[model samples]
Target: MRIIINTGKGGVGKSTISALTSINISKRLKTLLISSDLAHSLSDLFAIKLTANPTRICENLYALEINPIIESAKAWQNLNSYLRELVKNNSLNDIQVEELLLFPGLEDVFSLLKILEIYKEGKYEVLVVDCGPSAETISLLSTGEKLNNLADTLVPLVKRFNSLLGGFIEKKTEVKKPKDIVFDEFVGLAKKLYELEKILMNPEITSVRFVTKASKVISNETFRASTLMNMYGFLTDCVYINMLYPEEIKNSSYDNLYLEERENVDRIEEFYPDKRVFKIYMKANEVIGLKELESLNEEIFSKIYLEEFFTACRTFDIKSEGASKIIEIDFKFASDKEVDVRRIGNDLELSYLNFKRRFKLPDTLSSRKISSYSIEDEKLKIVMDYD
Candidate 1:
């Protein structure tokens, strides 16, 4: 199954683009479009009320606005109930306990869990995700990996607590520590998270599309987003400059806006030179409903297969070059400017003007020094010194 995720600045009409893209996909494949954001627009866009349960939009097309809180309640019910029973003296109501049980930004993770759950059902050919804003979505895509790491450390402590609670804590009610039930649930969640990372990081299974307006600020944010997308090992295939003004209009007062917006696209093209860039012209009226979305889809994606619209280059790879080693990365999005590179022991840090990620190199490569870096065939090759 193919997963297409759309994210951008909060008001770049990403939902509209997602609607259009999913409508187009549903024409050829069984598709489900999910609004995974807290503030939803799919209902307004589709002009139909929706719930966590998938609602049919058209033949072979389904859409829903997922409540991550609700998903979390369902998934973590045993754990939450056990905790509440264990600490009944804490003056917190069920609602307050529910809120306290939720980790910061865990709703985002729950949103992904929702995606993973549906993806495993084997019903749909494609799942189109209308993600939250770009920054938050970045956090969402990478949260699985980070949370898994945290779980590895936290699970043992939880087991110890479960043992202590079983012996010492007086049970006010029939509820126990729930170690078996909790661990089973935890294992189930961990499995889902592993699948989540596996699917999201796989290039062939997932494609991320960024939508932005044609302006310097928004385009630059999109550029930084592209860089982060690479850092987290997610694939970014399309960058859409939405709501672009046409070159011709009768107003001389708006000439400068038009010229600057034109330059904005040029800058974005140079920024994302390798990726397919799409320009969405400003429409006279709001593009809503399946009819209008179908019309726009025909106007936009007429030339090639929808699959052709997605592309992702290598993010990070290592290889042996003679006696030395090399790290190959797709820094094409940040290649035009000075990218800061530094090494401290086995950790390598690559920072563009604004964003970067530090990586822990392998133990075998710890003795090797960073010799040099150069862009060869659109890849940033960082060579390690053997001597």
Candidate 2:
């Protein structure tokens, strides 16, 4: 099983949750924990020096922090060199060429590649990933499909153009044509991304745990993040709200603070009614080292079955009713009053409270008109008629 811990904002105890979860899993099963964040803190959290290579932390636990510079040198030097040459040949300055050669999501791509490599090894029973901040994590998860699409559409066109213009361009600018190795590199990347996509989309093998704090800013970002994850077909099993004040401090000097936290907690529950929400109170001492992390893990997830905690909710499905097709959305734990639906081009946007989920309509449904829509049995059924 692979678990990814993610959050929209930083300093929300995401790394803490990931470490404790890994420790808990390692207690009973062999587990590998990976930090995909560029600004890594897993080593600090564990109080042990770590590197890009996996280091055995204990009997059944292993950990690694992805160093993008090292990983890029290992897996992306050829690709980067090709891009640099291409840019330099275009009459661009050295600074401009260098900037272009440093691809935006190369690190994220390498991170997924690393995960795929470890997962395929089949040496560990559980894999826990401490993902980067929300935007980068989303980009990393979406990179595979984007790269595959580019390979299918842009790569062949570029290759053909390069072949046709090689001699002419070389004579004009004294630039060398790109070798076959560059195209081979592109093909290799595409294949790896395709494999990673399959593993990420498989709910039985992977699940995402979203972490946030009980505040307006974090709560709002959490909703948007969860909606986007669902859009990409990633299953979010739970939402962890950390650093909550304990009830004992309710009427103390922190009464107002507790009230605000309570309100935010309620708001989160209302927003993500279907997800399991776990609140971890602020610890008396800083949570560090294996012993403290293990205790924290027990406090948060002692009776919880990590493997069986969440079954991915089937969000939508297509069905046949007589000669027409119907699109059914499962809005379990939600009500008609809570949902507002609208259509934008070929996409349907469903909003509940402050959370919005958008679904792209298939060609069959996009060409047809909505005949009727009804909410029944915790489902929003939209009947589509043949155009």
Candidate 3:
């Protein structure tokens, strides 16, 4: 089982939730907690220095903070060297070319590759990933699809063209062709990405949990992030709203703040009616270390089983009713006014605010026409006709 904890905004106590959840799971199962956030706070939260390598934290728990720079040196040295040579050949200075070696998205790519490797090792029963902020997590989740597409299309073409060019260049010019080792490295990388996609798209094996605080800004961002997660075929089973002031403080000077927080909490509950939403009240002091985290975990999840908490609703399903086919999409937490739907050729385009997704029609529905659509039970059901 893989659990990825993320938040739409910073300072929402995401790492704290991640740490405590791992501790809770490790009590019954062998668990590994990993921080893929560049600005890692897991070390501080656990009060132990962590490196790129896994460090045993307790009896059944281990932790690691991924350092993408070090991982790049290990996994991307050949690709970086090739790009550097190409840049130098174009007359760029060494300093500029060296700076260019640190490619955009390399951190996310290497972090995911490391995750794939660790998950395949089968050493741990459960893997808990403490991802970066929501935006970065969304990008990382979508990376598998993008990389798989490149591997299937671009990488094969590049390999064939490079091989042909190598033979021609060797016969005509003194220029050195790229070595077979470089092409082999790329092939291996592509295979890894393809496997990663399989792991991520399996809803039974992986689920994303969103952590957020009670605020208008954070709530809005969480809604948008949840939509994107659904678009990427990731199951979101729960929303954790953290750091709420205790209700017993009604007579205190912070009454007004509590009132506002209550309103925000109400909005969140309404937004995720289909999801298991957990709320944690703020404590008198900061939460840190295993002892405090264990208490925190109990306060939030004592009533439920961790394994049962991961059971999620399907995002979309296809069913045939008599002569017609129905495609139902679970758009819970979203109103009809907030969503836009259209048909583009053989695909369906769905847009919610700033987020948009295009889904290809299944083979059975590819030749069918969209007879009608309706929003019912917070679900968008589209009817297609065989004729």
TM-scores of all predicted structures: 0.83, 0.82, 0.83
User: Candidate 3's residue-wise lDDT over 1-387, tens digit each?
Assistant: 564555557889889888877887887888899998888999998888988888999899999999887676667678777776655658677666655765787687788888888888988888888888888887776666556555666877887887879779856884557776777776677678667866876777777888999988899889878877775577888888998888997878989988998999999999877788888888899887777877887877666655444555787788899999988877655777887777778777777666666656778889988888767886777888866
Name model 3 segments beyond 4 Å from true: 2-4, 74-77, 87-99, 156-191, 298-304, 333-362, 366-377, 382-387
Top-lDDT structure, candidate number: 1
Provide the RMSD of all predictions against the true structure, rounded to 1 decimal.
Answer: 4.2, 4.9, 3.9
Which candidate order results from sorting by lDDT in descending order?
A: 1, 3, 2
User: Model 3: which residue pairs collide?
Assistant: none
Q: Which stretches of candidate 2 lie over 4 Å from their true place?
A: 81-102, 326-386
Model 2 pairs in collision = none
**Overall local distance difference test of candidate 3:** 0.78
Write the residue-wise lDDT of candidate 1 on 66-128 in tens digits: 987788887787787778776687787878877777867688878888898898898999999
The whole-model lDDT of each prediction reads 0.80, 0.77, 0.78
- In candidate 1, stretches whose alpha carbon ends up further than 4 angstroms from where it belongs are 86-94, 157-188, 307-309, 332-387
